[model samples]
Target: MCLLLIAWKVHPTCPLIVAANRDEFYRRPTKPIHRWDDGSGIVGGRDLTSGGTWLGVTASGRFAAVTNVRDGKAEGTPPQSRGALPTGFLDSTATPQAYAAAADGDDFAGFNLLASDLDELFWVSNRFDGAGVAVEPGIHGLSNAQLDTPWPKVTAGKAALAAAVSEDSGAPDADVESYFELLHSTDPAPRADLPNTGVGVRREKQLSPLFVRTRFYGTRASTVLRVRSDGSFDLTERTFNSRRQTGETRIEETS
Candidate 1:
């Protein structure tokens, strides 16, 4: 299970709160946040499969994110590498609203996209039975298996992020860094079974309270993006080690 949550403008302190947990096999090759493309911008984590990204914004006030829909057997179509969607969004100039609008009736193929260009944000999910959806700025969440579930983790994370954003507007950078720390606060004790277990012994481990669970499918990367009224952008990305230790990089760029 994975979850993504977003909170916009209504918060008194911060304008946005995005917390997501990306779930996949533990052996996937991913790099924590780092400077990308000759240092023109910075992004957190890279999905080595398709070279796409999960979250990132350019110094030029452009932003976008995407999550794979767990409901698909997206295997024989076009054969694009995994995570290519987010990678493409990172380098593009499409605004969220425009991108969503453009995707309104197109075939979704096999993913969901969150595209933004300085002023607006957009969401489109091909997994939603082939329809694209427009989601406004507010507290929002999504998981790999579904759009939004009433799962306790989704509720708690969204609420916590919302509350924190409402309480701290002083330095977006500081608030963002603290938020990353909070997201990465998971225990590192090795588990005897895989999270998505098919083994009988794993079933026993899943039943153990100490087995450790992930909120948003073990948040692999965390990001914060801010846009000034003048249309410039500032962004930061924090990547976590397998042990969940964290490091961050910040960038500022004009549109």
Candidate 2:
């Protein structure tokens, strides 16, 4: 996912709320949100390219997501592979911080990694400048820029999404499902002066379903994760297969 916004324990009304857009090839392999073994479940789209997922949460309250580093080519050496960091470790493991900190000796840059388990959330970005300051639990926003950055889209979107969840009165699953649509929407109306509207994407479809007709190499998906203070998590995925509605998964027992 290129964009991710999450509201963590800081909120008084809602414990956790996430909205993200997964950008990947149309053919990437990913299953819709569903209950899985080990009592772990996935609610976000997985990376078909590397099997790493953009954003998702485990039933036990672990969460993670990542966005690309948007910048022009630089003068320095670039990484051997864009998929160097194992972001897949976020949702699948418990000791994510220890796992990531172990990669300090390894070369890293060009990608961002965010992860959260039962108690905390953390972020990592390997770039020429350096990895970013680690992030802690609290509402956070991330985009192509960096973690907890004040970029307009990341900052503004986080606030708006948080407000949406706070004001919601219905079931969190329904309210958060609606919030997914808000994040997944990318209305592609043409711009008069800009020609291409400056919007990198041509159309927005759920589940990496939309085809741009160019080798179909693109990212398209959205995942919403909801976690309550009582130690329960839910993941809902909206993909090409399930256009508007999301496939739901209950991680830990809420009842």
Model 1: per-residue lDDT, tens digit, 1-255?
A: 144666655554434446555544556667655667655464546767656667765655565666655432434555464355555666656656555555532333456677665456666776565334556667766544344553344555566676666665634345565455445434332354223323344432422221124332234455655555454545666555445636666665553
Candidate 1 TM-score, true structure as reference? 0.70
Using all chains and alpha carbons, the TM-scores for the candidates as numbered come to: 0.70, 0.68
Model 2 lDDT per residue over 1-255, tens place: 666777766555446677776665656576554443433455444444455455666555666666666564453554433343434454346465765555452354456777667466667776424433456656677765567666444555676676666766535455565566567544322232112212334332221121112246433556666677765655555554323333444333463
Question: Residue 123 in candidate 1 has what lDDT?
Answer: 68
- Candidate 2 regions off by >4 Å? 35-44, 74-96, 104-109, 128-132, 136-138, 150-152, 169-174, 187-219, 241-255
lDDT of 2: 0.54
